[model samples]
Target: MPSPSGENPWSIPENDRLSERDFGRIAELIGEHAGIKLPPTKRLMVEGRLRKRVRGLGHQSLADYCRFLFDGHGLTSELVHVIDAVTTNKTDFFREPTHFVALEEKIVPALLERHASPEPRIKLWSAACSNGAEVYTIAMVMAEIAARHRHLRFSVLGTDISTEMLEYAAQAIYPVAMVEPVPTALRNRYLMQGRAPSRRSEVRIVPELRNTACFARLNLMDTRYTIDRDVDVIFLRNVLIYFEKATQEAVVSRLVGHLRPGGFLILGHSESMIGSNLNLRQVAPAVFQKS
Candidate 1:
């Protein structure tokens, strides 16, 4: 039964057919504008995520919300929210721990030998560093390595597209659940577990580890980024899956451009530099060294 006006699609009850088309249009628009690729088959998931956004904006219909997004309003904010909601950020301390061990055993030593000084400095970038477990873990490794070497200095800069996620990273606090998987020694050394006087429980990163990291918001799709200097290593893991093939190549090219010659590029275990013509050669499983 249609409403009195008969043209208000909002009044037409929500159903599979209605959602499918709108979702496809949204996917197309996002891909065109931001290089994010969402398959048509994911229409239901997209609708489910955007339904809350539409309701929050007090739009009576998905069509209205879609129109608002497409009509040249401040839609980037909503799109960022959509990306944050849809992207899988499942990560933990020393995820794919072998990579960390390899860095400790071989890469760090080679870098130290190359510099041959009392204090050799390096900078690493954690691209798409969601909520910053990876960045903090990188700090932990640096600290541990520095302790043994007594002649190394390192810092990690973590960047993400979501402000909400960056806020979480800045606080350097996590619930007990977040620290449970961390190695016992590392947890004790790097994380301060306690409750402040006025509030709930929290685990804070110690000053030594916290000082070694900086977090910021950066849209990888944006060509005019502020990262001015070359980086020694970049962990651009698991983010390319959200992009189309061309976008993936572009993103990889941009990331590779930031790496110093002979620096490392690390991707997720399931990710690779497929279809990307970067000057990086695979050195290990999911690890590539820039040539």
Candidate 2:
């Protein structure tokens, strides 16, 4: 049978073909476990990603690999690898800078007006902080705020579903080009370049920002989050595009539960909360405030 789009379904290399049934099952498991919705459209992408895992694990066929994930007995370690492969982790420093601009221009000033106190603490959560860019971006902005308002304290809690990504975040080491988008002054202030020969082409987050930040593994499918109860901002950008509407609502609800009453919730530019039925009021492009 021709593919739904009137092209070859088996266009993927015959050596690493992912059958329709296996793709469906994998999609279902990923959706159920990680709240990531995978449809037939993602078959090629999924196949390309999981193919590496299949080869690395020495599974001769895609069927054997799927079986290892679904039916194989008592191999929890393989499941983590499969889930890690299926999830997307595309992000970089100062991504969606307008949001950070908004934080400085509108959100933070309003927060200061309402929540200022002795030894003030501003807690923010980078909900889908892929790698470490978004968390450190928040840290950089907060670092600026802290310098100006010496009384204010800033703490960022970065969370993700994939342990591998969280591990990368914990180290806070990234390529040289990754920090290139950061302006010169901020880059010098917040990033440390590796020395020649051994550690070339790399930069790590400065120790002070690293000390102010922390990371945790969190699957948005869960009902309760493992972060602090109250937070002033949540940067859940770009990741929700992978989830279906119902999944988005469920995840947003859980995130909303952790946000302070008047705190800000920022979604990706493409994602939306219209008719999401959550108790949030839109304040900017993809930005919302909990009422």
Candidate 3:
């Protein structure tokens, strides 16, 4: 059959062959290192992404890349690139504005009522924070709210597996086109226009807002990352769809483990705990509370 592009699907050579044992090895390697599962289907997907890497690196086959990964060359770096390629990071300023509104109206107030004391602290994690927009948006909201409530403090921790994305996040800069949907008042308050070192002058989030958040390179698959301070809310949004059933369960368990008792866990609107079987109770629309 011809593909939608009108090219014969079979005309292309079978670029990669993923054996059952190789699939198991891929799953074990990814799971042990990054808590990601490479099911047979996803293993094929990985093969497709790495097929070009094989050509680029002058390797004979996908098996060669696997061997390179095991020969102490530490393909974790390359694996991270593969993840960056496969993971979709489509987000914008206040993409789901209602959740921020709810946080401002209901959640933040409730958290303050309980924890508003000397050095009162609130910790939030953007588990799959991509390119920093969501993290910065959360920071802007918290900073605005905290300014009004002197008795409370808040900090945001944005973590992602892609070092390339983190570099953009750390720079705290975005192009003008990316800021179109941002409201003017908020844009002026939170973002400033200036020349980057190379990309010329561009719009950037104000240092005051940027200062309130921190970005880290983290792989969500790591099971032992226990953030010492209990988190009040976690924005593990829009990133779980790529995982398989068992992998999704393991990731949720690790996520809930980091969540403080009674803390809220939010996922992408399309994602749900219906089949996830995680230990969380539905509190609001698309929102789950740790038991």
What is the C-alpha lDDT profile of model 1 across 46-125, one tens digit per residue?
Answer: 66556666777798767777677767574776777766655556568778887898778867775666664678887889
Overall local distance difference test of candidate 3? 0.74
Better of 1 and 3 by lDDT: 1
lDDT of 2 by residue, 89-138 (tens): 99988888899999888888878887858777889999988798899999
The better-scoring model by TM-score among 1 and 3 is: 1
Number of the candidate with higher lDDT, 1 or 2: 2
lDDT, each prediction: 0.75, 0.83, 0.74
Error in Å for residue 125 of model 2? 0.2
**Candidate 3 residues 130-214, lDDT tens each?**
8999898888888888888786778899898878788889888898888776778788899887765765547888888888889
TM-scores, all candidates, are 0.83, 0.90, 0.77
Task: Please list all clashing residue pairs in model 1, or write none if there are none.
Answer: none
Off by over 4 Å in 2: 1-15, 274-277
Off by over 4 Å in 1: 1-18, 72-77, 196-201, 273-277
Evaluate residue 112 in candidate 3 and report its C-alpha lDDT on the 0 to 100 scale.
Answer: 70
lDDT for model 2 comes to 0.83
